[model samples]
Target: MTNTRSRGAASRGGWIRQYHHPRGDAPTLVCFPHAGGSASAYFALSAALSEGAEALIVQYPGRQDRLDEPALKDLGELADGVVAALAPWTGRPLTLFGHSMGSVVAYEVARRLERGPGPGPAGLVVSGNMAPSVQRDQGVHLMNDEELMTWMSDLAGTPPAVLADKELLATIAPALRADFTALETYRHPEGSSVECPISGYVGDHDPHVPHDGFLRWAEHTKAEFTVQVFEGGHFYIEDQVQDVARSILRDLSAFVSRRLARHPLA
Candidate 1:
């Protein structure tokens, strides 16, 4: 799959990938991929929102084209790198979306942006993960290769072909472990919350996220909070891309309306 780089996108040190370009005035939607996932995972989503928004998918280190780069084992460091890479794309209203480990990273990035000089995210959408405040000690990152593969298989997030291919699994294992280590070791400060609204999404049968887990995201936002449960497992978006895209567009529209009400002249 060939990807087109928007002007200056290549200057971000390969941290961002743009699959489709939207109108210049359109809102920006920055997507963070799940653990062991690459920016290509969002190609379909970016295509879906091509007309309504500019979608920028993050490309984390140590995966895909960035295989040579070492993956960061700390979530804070990962967030820091993302925040820095996003500095060039903050001119317009932006919304953030992330799944699984990416959800936590997006939250951290939103927090940092809120604390910085520029405007923070117009809103945030967190999917397939629990709230940052809720911490569990399931150390899958420390598991042996076989055990880790078993857990991944149970989650059904990985493709069967990739799982069956030992060489492919071995190639991605280090980056997968690094992502899991960052996710598992992350610790959110009590009472830390973003000022923007938050929308949570979860699959009804996702084992990693409890049935009511998405609701916890409300605690991390100071503004309006909402959640929608979809059918399927952790990778529900794969089957419900249109629905997910609609939900995102709906939330983004609402966020824009709210912002307009607050600052009519801007």
Candidate 2:
């Protein structure tokens, strides 16, 4: 496996980012970042799993290299863009992992893929988000700049340095607002569920979603469902990257095993 990070023009796709090269035979783990986060957010996890899985992080518009592009304000549109952009990499087994708002996006993408002719993701790992069915209308998108920054501070998702720097906060506010809008306004239709196994993770002390809320994800998956509780808050993965990577790899391995059992000749 080749380990390298590329952010040059050649690496700039509207959606996917492959920071490291893994074995062709390795399963692909497609990661969706939390709201206001860029693909670079998953760089460490990508590096950690470089040998076991090909990690492809989604880069939504209005951030990083795609800064010039308009940010999507609807979850459906975001999921559509991701599903289409994933065309070339669907040949191998795929496991979708998403955090915060990205969890719903990953669920939607998995639903779309299963509805299509191709096979759906082998499994889904949702972190720091409640099941889509549990709707909460948080008006974070409607907050003014000051309020928005304050909210981000309370959640501890944004760094103190970034929160304190007005100039930097202003730069990312648009994308952040757009993401909030998409998340707040989105609703998952009743009975909408995925065929893939779903694994949920959440920090024990997360302010946004409680442990029970995380377990509600079981309702959205027809297959096996499991949950892992970690220490800290919503951004727990920030401190537990290695443990998270190990859990993800274990899920990916199980997915592969299940896939092989279904089609042993493959």
lDDT of 1: 0.84
- Model 2 residue 213 lDDT? 70
Q: How many steric clashes does model 1 contain?
A: 0
lDDT tens per residue, model 1, 1-266: 11233446633557988877776557778899998889999989889887787788999999989999998899999888888888776654569999998999999999988887666778899999999988855988998887888888888879899989899999888888999999998899889999889999999888778755567888899898888889989999999999999899888888867766786632
C-alpha lDDT of candidate 2 relative to the true structure: 0.86
Per-residue lDDT of model 2, residues 103-203, tens digit only: 99999999998887666688899999989988767789999999999988988988899998999888899999999999999999888999889988888
The residue ranges of model 2 lying beyond 4 angstroms of the native Cα positions read 1-12
> Candidate 2, which ten residues in sequence have the lowest lDDT sum?
1-10
Any residue pairs clashing in model 1, and if so which? none
Best by lDDT: 2
Clash statistics: count for each candidate: 0, 0
RMSD of each: 3.0, 2.9
